[model samples]
Target chain A: MNRKSKDGKILLLQGNEALAEGALAAGCRFFAGYPITPASEIAEHMAMKLPAMGGTFIQMEDEIASMGAVIGASLAGVKAMTATSGPGFSLMQENIGFACMTETPCVVVDVMRGGPSTGLPTLASQGDVMQARWGTHGDHPIIVLAVSSVRDCFEIAVFAFNLSEKYRVPVIILSDEVVAHTRETFVPPSPDEIEIFNRVTPTVPPEWYIPYEDTGAGVPAMAAFGDGYRHHVTGLTHDERGFPSQRSDEIDALMRRFFRKITQGFHEIQRVETFMMDDAEIAVIAYGSVARSSRRAVIDARERGVKAGLLQLVTLFPFPRRHVEKVLQQCRAVLVPELNIGQMSREVKRVHRNSSRVETLNRLDGRLITPREIGDCLIKMYY
Target chain B: MAEGMTGLVHKYLRHDKKFPHIWCPGCGNGIVLGSLIRAIDRLGLDKNKVALVSGIGCSGRMTTYADFNTLHTPHGRALTFATGLKLSREDLTVIVIMGDGDATAIGGNHYIHAARRNVDMTAIIVNNQVYGMTGGQYSPTTPYGAMTTTTPYGMVEHAFDISALAVAAEASYVARCTVYHAALLDQLIESAIRRKGFSSVEVLSNCHIQFGRRNRMASPVKMLEWFKENAVRMHATSKMKPEELQGKFIIGVLADSERPSYNDEYEKVREKARGISVEPKPPARFEG
Candidate 1:
């Protein structure tokens, strides 16, 4: 896996393969995942690669176990991750919520495939946009990134681990089947070139260390399981001492900190790639692989003497509301094309004051929305 | 590290913040916890080098009360987490605590797989024969024909021999002891903790508040008395017929063997992976 060449050569690899390399570069020493379509390659790569790098990769019995194990490894002070698709993602929700409640830093990669159940195991879809945000129960904070390119599959993975450590929360790297299995060439970033944020450790004595004590950053310093600063971690609503508390004040305080940690940093957390949007009457908002279709559609609309631009979302959660509102203000109509029936459209409408100004172009036939379909929708809405 | 068993209890238990243990008054979790504390102390295990994981149940609450790297996860996923924790940092001693229902029902698949892999951790399953935290539901280990909230009349489900299951799953060490047998429970737990491969010790504990009351053995004392009368040692089970052993609780070292644990085998994989010769596969498929 550490096939670092002295010549700085670019390695041709699939999106999932690049992810394994990226995680290893970011100091990930653990991977636990159950095999599933679109995401299975990531585990296969990890199984073949991790051990060679002195890391551990375990293909657990199921997705539930896989998610639980990754969180456990993260608590043991290793950068850990688990990769899965539709069915596996549903199974992983329980422990993802537990990781959220426990404030353990880990990464979960959901390679998007079409589905409500196991609808399409190998086809691309962004149907899980809402699930990625609210899949876990309760009002817990999460950071989810949608990567559209093979390069992003590598870079954002390193970024996912960084965000997870910085916020002390599970950061999801969402990849569509197209992006996951697609092969491309990219120069792997050197360890020194990529900025990695490791979870901060407490300077105080073991007796004084409160595992869940929120500092000025809102993210608490974490002590690993074997760090000698032995402390408790639990999914139960816990006090600052990290012990379960039924006291209303304790529960309130913990939940407030969890949400505030990410919500307050919305400006830094939200990332959107805008194309040709400086002056346009029509705006198209899309994410994941659909963004590629939307981009081409925007270009075609421009050539056809119609003013159009693209709002390609890279960060999906805490849904770039301000950016969405800004784009809507400049444009008369917004076209949101997704693989599912209007999951992100609702989010867009929620942010835009005039919900009627936004239109959803959905495709659920186990196929991707084409450039022509998006172009047609933009014209129908704005022209 | 120098503390005796009693001193370790004071040292390890979170006295300031965690008080008033959450278990019911008549529950045997206290004895179970006490035995565990003593076992860890006697084994001279590093308190800092241990990570305790537990699932949702009365037993799940134990991790929060212990002064170690503790995780309280969803019901039945403790062993999965423990496996991950141990695999990541092989130096740390990971222990998982779960109730009978949590271990044998919802978490059954993970439990069997962990033992099958021979994961290097000690699983301390507190079997009270019923789901205590969520009220009285019949667990997989609930004695056949016992009344529970879920099993209104008599339990229609068969009892599971979890220790025997672990042994069959190839756990390096498998043992069981009742709360009435406090000294034996502690000893068995200590031995399990000190063992290398995947080891388990089922702590047959009293849950008078849940599993009793309906079965006509409501008091905690009556539960203990039943355990004292019914528990059979390992050797006696060999002499008894299936019919004769129907009402008995086998409590002893049921299985013990030597095998390379999961972690041990993984290290060999890592050793073999280093600078291995690579040979690309021959192309067979038409498409690139």
Candidate 2:
């Protein structure tokens, strides 16, 4: 079956292409990125399409500049994004921290590949799960989303942009080489069908506007560069007026607002999928490409008279802890499987509150965790 | 006629922000700031249309005083940020302020690349010869044999001629001026900002508190005298021999050329994509 795109034509789209199209649909008018494997297609697609929409696309010298440009463009009252793989993603951490400190809204697409240092460029791995959460130094709040399929790629990119704009924070969408390069049937949402969220502009006059003022809602209205609101923006620990403040109280209040905006808005940010987990003794928790394999394993286990269910994580950073906690209390034994050596499983272990036994299935040789391996593990745990 | 200095200050500065700035007394940064505002005032550009982006250092704090849409970014990345701002809002005038270490040492890649790409922005790099904000560490433009906190046993590396590097990188406009020459500094900055492509103005500023005390020039006056006695105009250097210009540096515009800016060239790409003559019509509409 074929699904219609914006032009009302059915098309087979790569995951990267769908992600770019989703960004365009989300009103992303500016893209700045350096070309890297597994993620370069996102940049290529944006370069080809952004101009037709009367948008801007720039191939910056490196990922550092690319991240800087995206943040800058976002401040100029346009939605902006950047894409990179592991190596380039590592280079973007400096500016990423700046974005967090300044509360700038932008999107970063990191296509996961095997890595410690320029690790496998073409092969798939979920190694960047931890890096996405704690890559930049300091205790900062970040939103990380994972895609399990090509269609998920399209939906998640739009969600990422909306979350970033609504909260005024940088959002990261993690895609592995498997999903980014795979071709699948895609039905893009029409412009009117999907809701779009833009950053809130200042409603007050220029004299009353404070660039970083916390209005009890934790998010402040933003003003563009050329707007009459001549406000100052800095990465320093700033006061309500956006000037660098060394006062202990001001710094404490500002840092608290950064976390408060996300934790308080989790209702709009977090998502998870539970499959047949209502009355099951055995459960599997997974995310990204590994979730697809785990879903298959759960279905196969049920056919063999074993009660098995699957928990698929979409929001990875603010770690869907409450949902995972519910599953932990209901199930007797849970298995966590992933491509990397137990990154997300650690989060599962951290949220363990009940008497349920938790175990992890791991792989690191640039290969996807197969359904057979997960099924075997589920069978052993059940028997 | 140029506006009175006090009027320019009143019109362009943010009075509500932190006054009594962080720069040391007798610092040349204040003079450079004055020249910048005078240049902007002389050009008659609207305050709402100017975007002043700065990088980390003592120089980066310039944005705190300016009334424009000021942004103080991370160290060495002001050009990158300015590039995005200018490309997105080409209607606005963009200016980037950076220090010696901020522009040449940590941001050398962006400096050269911004020149190569020729984005329409003016970069005013304050070459104070040392990183004054970080306690006088020797920077990329620290003169050889000059003493700094990092170069205790006399400096071993050579200094970078920032304007020459900009010229080599093919910046459409490149010029050099010193803080002591405030009037000339205003003219160079005004012209650089008016140019269509990437323009760099390297201001030889004095860190009287740091580099000046460590070197022979112990006070601001001594540093100003050094700039006055050792500088030669660019036109006069052609007549003078190499021996006469051994220790002296050239001042004035070194390179100015006409080339299409990145934005103008990108417009052509936009036309090729969406122009009626190039784009083919859809053969048939899809029936749901």
Candidate 3:
């Protein structure tokens, strides 16, 4: 099928540059980061771009401070973000956990390089999918979005910030090195084209404001510093007034509310794009740069009459499990080809535990999974 | 209400939510906290425009009882958060309070960098010579020959003159005072809060339970007496020999200069970036 028409002005960009421009467009006025491989472009762009926009950009001493600064800026009532690859992302986990515990809304873009202590800094790998979910300590909830192409990076960057502000949480934009380094034409939408969300504020006067009270939307309205709210915010688990309350009942209530906030908002939190799935029996699931190959594979499989389709996962966390399970219920078997070995495949299998066999096409050699490799799997699985 | 200082304490402390503030009885943190409150009160800074950030430990608890926009961060990370918050919103009077270990031990990197940058924030470090909250463990400031849980026999490492370190690290304003010198501590803090660049005060505070119990100075009065007896003034330091100053430190304003703050420097950067008075004009917001 030939694509017909498109709107918006075109600008050629790499995945990392798209992410930087996308974040700026999404109302990110504060960026603090330490440079790391495959993700330095974002920081460079911010350093070059933020100041002219009357925003703040800082090259922090390290990644821990970068994440801390973003959280700090967010608490001061401005949208903020930081980007890093795996090693820097590892350092960021400490404050990432801090942000989650304190319920600070911000964005973190982890352009994936092979990791587990800087395993292939210059190469591409979808190695941080699970790290994006469980990299930080504790059972705290997080939202992560995966981008497959340059244009998608721009779009998802906006979505990531929107989800962060709407839910008052940190949202991770996970991009692989292939997507990060490759160049593509990105269309810039008009200002009103994308929806932006700000943290909900208490309508009541400052005296009556309970900083952590559930706003019936599973989120506590956040008051910015200097807003005359004069509320205490801490990393320790606390009660409605935002002070450290260690009572077991209070802990349980707060913990349950953290999960409910993301779980109840699943419809908005989960995003996936389906291609040629109607009347198809076999599907290929992929994300980030691997999805680019999977797209070509699905197209070639269709030309060969294999009845193959593509399930592009845009939202990797809160893991679109229900939707994936529903899609798997219609297919015979799904092929998952990612840049890493069996990260998201585990989530897919767990979701479709008894429904169908979940096949994996993994690559760990720092190279892209080509279209033939995916189409071969499709042919073999379908026949 | 109770009369005298207790009345001011009652009025300033957040008694409803954060009462019985985790601080132990006769703790010198109470004295140090009182001095901080008196300084802020004397400054007449609007509570809404003030922000108090603290790191993990006895000192971090100060944020909870303070009725400002307070933040209690992880151990050793208060300065980084304060820097971020202050940089983003230059309208707030940001103040950071940390313990000896929280400042000079784990967060030493952030402490020095914040000072080097000379950001417009006041950092107050309460040096009780040991990590009291985690038990009587040796901290960065534990003097040589001091015994603690970590150093069973005695501390083999040399102690840091935190005030001198701040002065060396290019902080715009640095001072030192003991909890015993309450009124002088108030005056130094008032001047620090008014300083336009990085300002800090190393308070040679007390730890009656931790350092006191381990070192045979078990009572609160004995610790206060030690501070009163051993404290030296900044003016008197020049007359004393280096050997004579052993096991004691001077308490006064050690350094003060009107260096341009990081916030002010960043403004010039913004102006240069936008070509406000020269060169080509850049696009607004995200367009560039």
Candidate 4:
């Protein structure tokens, strides 16, 4: 409980380290993970800090086990988390879906790196943008928050945990290599200023505790393992009794609710920062590290007398379609700069189909897409 | 933590839902589930304190029927999830039930590591020799020369000896049993549950409809009979090598040793965190 509070002053720390500090601030008591590059620092930080705080930290055999451990620990009434990179994140998808189906509250921090495989361990890439949205083979909706800066990494990590617990679903904090490795000044908030959400505990007796029965809040009240509330949770399509139901109607109803629960709150879930969009005829839509580069490009373009604006996406999963539509309605053309070969640009084009011109500026060779490149793309499109 | 014995009959078993257990009639999954329920009853573990974690497979269906804190996780990942449950709630008894395909094939890495760390949990693997749920596919435990839907002629690859694997991986208590030996299996399961470290009980069950029919033991009764005939006690099989029993099954306690369990060792670290010594007070040792 004796945490160091530095009077709201900025302290230099890596993005991964900031995430660890942010999770600690959000009351994360249990961390289970296997080491993977770029994201290993988060696990290392939690391994050293959690035990000292009377919490548990486990280096699991693999990423899959790490995910499983956190889910299990969460059921035991503790806030749990794990961190991984591309390959490990892919391995965790099935269990991530399991957490979704069961409505388990947990946080997974994915430090994005290159590839469909073990592409780049130390290099950064945003290729996992689509994977974060549709990685698991199911219709379940997920909440993914993208962090563009070291400070944003810390804030979003805390926010991810809060949203995860509030919705009784796993919240993913997506950070690419540029944001994960970059060191920046961040102020750790006092406990009073930080918002923390805990899983809703059941007040009903053991016999009356139906694990999957919703409280009309779309999230069922959870009972930790030793609290004596006997309930069942499964990845299979289950009815309100928490028993597996193979019936089509039951499966349909459950799947619909699962997607609707998160998708319905898109207005609340979506977070984007708009710059110079009110007066601009051209816009650049970007997220994560690319967003930072796009911001610089927008600044440079405005100085050069081009009407270019920036739409920086902070929450990537809900896609911020409404915002994209609004921007496209006003702008004549949209430029999406990313580290992948047109992943989010496809989504932008899909939403703004036939309404606006959409162009992509992608770089996948383990190099950071620079502001100059984005500026060049804007200049070419405008002039 | 409370030790009390109760009658074998489980009041929670749904009798109204008779017949069609969702498993093939000759499948050893039913027998394994019976042993599990009996063990729970014998241990008198509060139903509320029992958490059954399972991965995707035919055996995974046990979580649905068992009236307790059941977690049906993804394929081959039950151990990882159960590890979380056990470490988070040290008082609750966490048991993982998974099939051969789920446990040894896809989840093999987790199984070995769970054993190596000796986490305090019980893993019950229903080794039916084939992937029955996915339709007659050869599994990691499928014997050499065994025919399956995938392996039309015969499988040339060797089968995994899960008990031996667990023993080598440092599981504190490792045992093997067959569904035919119901009473003995119940006792083994109960002992494994009571063991203070990571314990693995490989139940050699039958997928009579798939593996059984493919291997010529078509009927459920005949499959159970084959298990009975092939199994020999550890004492009887001591002089024989694994190759000597190529087509046969050997069922007995494989390994038992004393090792510091993950939870007990974790508590020692916790005590140190609280500024207390983990070592008990010792008198001076005399020279021999």
What does candidate 4's lDDT look like per residue over B67-153, in tens digits? 778888988999999988888888889999989999898999999999998999999999989998889899999989999999998
Query: How much does candidate 4 score in TM-score?
Result: 0.92
Ranking by lDDT: 2, 3, 1, 4
Where is the poorest 10-residue window by lDDT in model 4 chain A?
Answer: A1-10
For all the models shown, what interface RMSD does each have? 4.0, 3.2, 4.6, 11.8
Give Cα distance to truth, residue A362, candidate 2, Å.
0.8
Q: Give candidate 3 misplaced runs (Cα > 4 Å).
A: A1-9, B1-4, B276-288
lDDT per residue, candidate 1, B18-78, as tens digits? 8778778878998998888888887888888888888989988888778777888899999
> How would the docking of model 1 be graded?
medium
Model 4: per-residue lDDT, tens digit, A245-292?
878987887777777777767777788999998899999999898899
Please write out the lDDT profile of model 2 over residues B73-189, one tens digit for every residue: 999999999988988898889999999999999999999999999999999999999999989999998889999999999999988889989999999999998998999999999
Mind giving the per-residue lDDT tens digits that candidate 2 earns over A1-383? 11346556665778898888889888899999999999998988888877877889999989999999998898899899999999999999999999999999999999999998899999999999988999998989999999989889888988999999999999999999998988876566666788889889999999999889887779999999998999889989899889999999999999999999999988878899999898789999998888999999999999998899999999998989998888899988999998888998888999897679999999999989999999999999999
TM per candidate, chain B: 0.93, 0.94, 0.94, 0.89
lDDT of 3 by residue, A21-61 (tens): 78988999999999899999999888877887889998888
What is the C-alpha interface RMSD of model 3?
4.6
Clashing pairs in 1: none
Error of 1 at A87 (Å): 0.8
Q: Mind giving the per-residue lDDT tens digits that candidate 3 earns over B1-288?
A: 247677777667787767877888888888788888889888999989999999999989999997789999988899989988998999999999999999998888888888998989999999999999999999989989999999999999998778777898899999999999989999999999999999999998889899999898898899999999999999999999999998886899999999999999999888888875332422121212
**Candidate 1 overall lDDT versus native:** 0.87
Cα lDDT, all candidates: 0.87, 0.91, 0.88, 0.85
- Deviation in angstroms for B22 in model 3? 1.3
Worst 10 contiguous positions by lDDT, candidate 4 chain B: B279-288
Docking level for model 3: medium
